[model samples]
Target: MMYKSTLSVKKEIALHLLFWVIWVYFTLAVVDANGIHFAEMDLFSSTWCITYVVTFYVNYLFVLPKVFHPFKWIKAIAGLVVIFLFFAALRYFLEQFLTVQLFNVQNYNPGTGILYYIYDNTFYAARPIILSSAFWLIVLLVRLLDYNKYIIEEQKNTEIKFLKAQINPHFVFNTLNNIYSMVHFQSPNALPAIEKLSSIMRFTTYEAPRNFIRLGEELNYIHAYLELEELRHYDKSFVSWETTVQSDNHEIPPYLLSPLVENALKHGSYTAEIPIIIRLSCNDQQLDFEVINRIGNQKKDKLGGIGIDNLKNRLEILYPEKHTLQTTEQEGLFSAHLVIYFQ
Candidate 1:
């Protein structure tokens, strides 16, 4: 922390030096353009620049922050009045007294009234006052924007972690229930189902926690889950899945696809006549997935199993406007279609 603070201070000092350097160059340019002799203008411009720098820092360091708070406009006005007077008095002392005594030149007429001198210098003081305040305001705005971006990024990561955490337990609970049913029936498929469960659990434990995984790894998990489900139902032909991929190296959010499969198996009806239909096709541009199933005799909530709301939230966070998920029920069939465009 101390190192960072030192670095920040160094940068700030560099910026201030840069500002003054540029100001000096421009002031000299203007003075020379006015046809003043170079040697005399050096003395005048040096005094003027020094006075402007003092005015700039006085308001910056002492006045603006204290007076510029919310509900302090009256204080701000008073503060500016104080700065204007200070600037005029300081300039009068240096230019009228010191410069005249040393170089025999005075910026103002020797006999000018005090009020007119103060009023006339207002025009000069306005530049340093306004520019310095503007610089402060710009720095404050940029800091605020950086802090806001940091806060947003933190919130996004926290929510995604929460949503990812929810998926694993939900999937494990349903899979365990299927295994329990097979074990209670003393079915021959119980041992194979348990083995399949081990593979699924390994993926969920180790791989699923990552933000992304190889698309082929997720597909392998899906294949294991389907085989386990087939053993439970005692029918390999009742579920159909077709996948065409341009490459297996594409990355995907872990467990993103499994919920659709789980939802179908949990709520869908299966028979030789009308099997559950799952289709997926992926290319460099996008991924397309669809699942269709026959409606069963059992009542099912469209948004129930695997929680469509949860799925929708994850999709919105991960893909934003780049993906679409649509579901519809018509003519004894329920279907879900998902399309995700890669960035």
Candidate 2:
């Protein structure tokens, strides 16, 4: 917390210095163009620059916050008017003192009486207020943009958490049902199935909680799930798993690809002669995952179920335009193809 606060203070100081440097450069250039002596121009510009800086910081630190509060609109407006008038008077007096008293600038017009003096210098006094208001507007704009960025990040995190909660319960229920079926049949594979279930539970409970995990970790989880399914069906089901991963270092959203494999096994026809084929390939730039299964007489829903719908929502949130998902049903074959592009 302290480190971040110190960094913020440093940035503010740097920005303040940059603004003042630019102001000084422009002020000197205008004075020089007016054919004033270099020394006189320097002194004159420096004096008014202080007043401008003071006006800006005072309004920015105090008055601007009050002005932004909708409930204090009337009081804030009155305060702003008072602040402008006070600074304007100060600027007028300082200019007069520096030019007439210090520099004795010739042909300096001193208007008749206090009324004429106020009238003539009123616009000059308002210069600082106008410049300060412009600066305040810019500061407010930057702060608003930062606030919007923060809101978007928070929303994304909330959505991810909700999705994970939904996935875990659904996954556990399905896996438990598969295990129960194997035990009822008095299959010898039941013990090995329980061991694979332990590994799946560990991955889902631990790794799935994170926003992102290595592509390899997700693939390992998928392999474990497929192994568990193999024990349940035995020789009744056949799965052809092919993978060509160029690198395991790539990062992806956790449990992203598992749903596609799960959907394929759940809906696939074990009675069919052909085996269910699950193909996954990845290179440096893109990942291609395709799952094909025989439909038999069962009607396949192209839009998919809760798990697939959840997967789509997560893909949209995490990958957006970077991913493509296509489902095609040709003859009795149902295929789901997904391609994800790395940034």
Best of the candidates, TM-score: 1
Please give, for residues 99-138, the per-residue lDDT of candidate 2 as tens digits: 6677775223666476766566566556666666677677
**Ten-residue stretch with the least lDDT total in model 2:** 1-10
Clashes per model (N, Cα, C within 3 A):
0, 0
> Per-residue CA lDDT of candidate 1, range 1-343, in tens?
1112222556767878888777666655445566743344666677787889899999888888778665387898898999998898889889899998898998888799988988788899999999888877766676667667766767777787887788888878878988999999999999999999999989988998888998899889988988888898898888787889989788998877777877787788887679989899999999998889887777662646544567788899889999999889999888988899996
Clashing pairs in 2: none
| TM-score of every prediction relative to native | 0.82, 0.81
Predicted structure 2: lDDT = 0.76
The parts of candidate 1 lying over 4 Å away from their true place are: 1-18, 30-44, 67-75, 85-114, 304-306
TM-score for candidate 2: 0.81
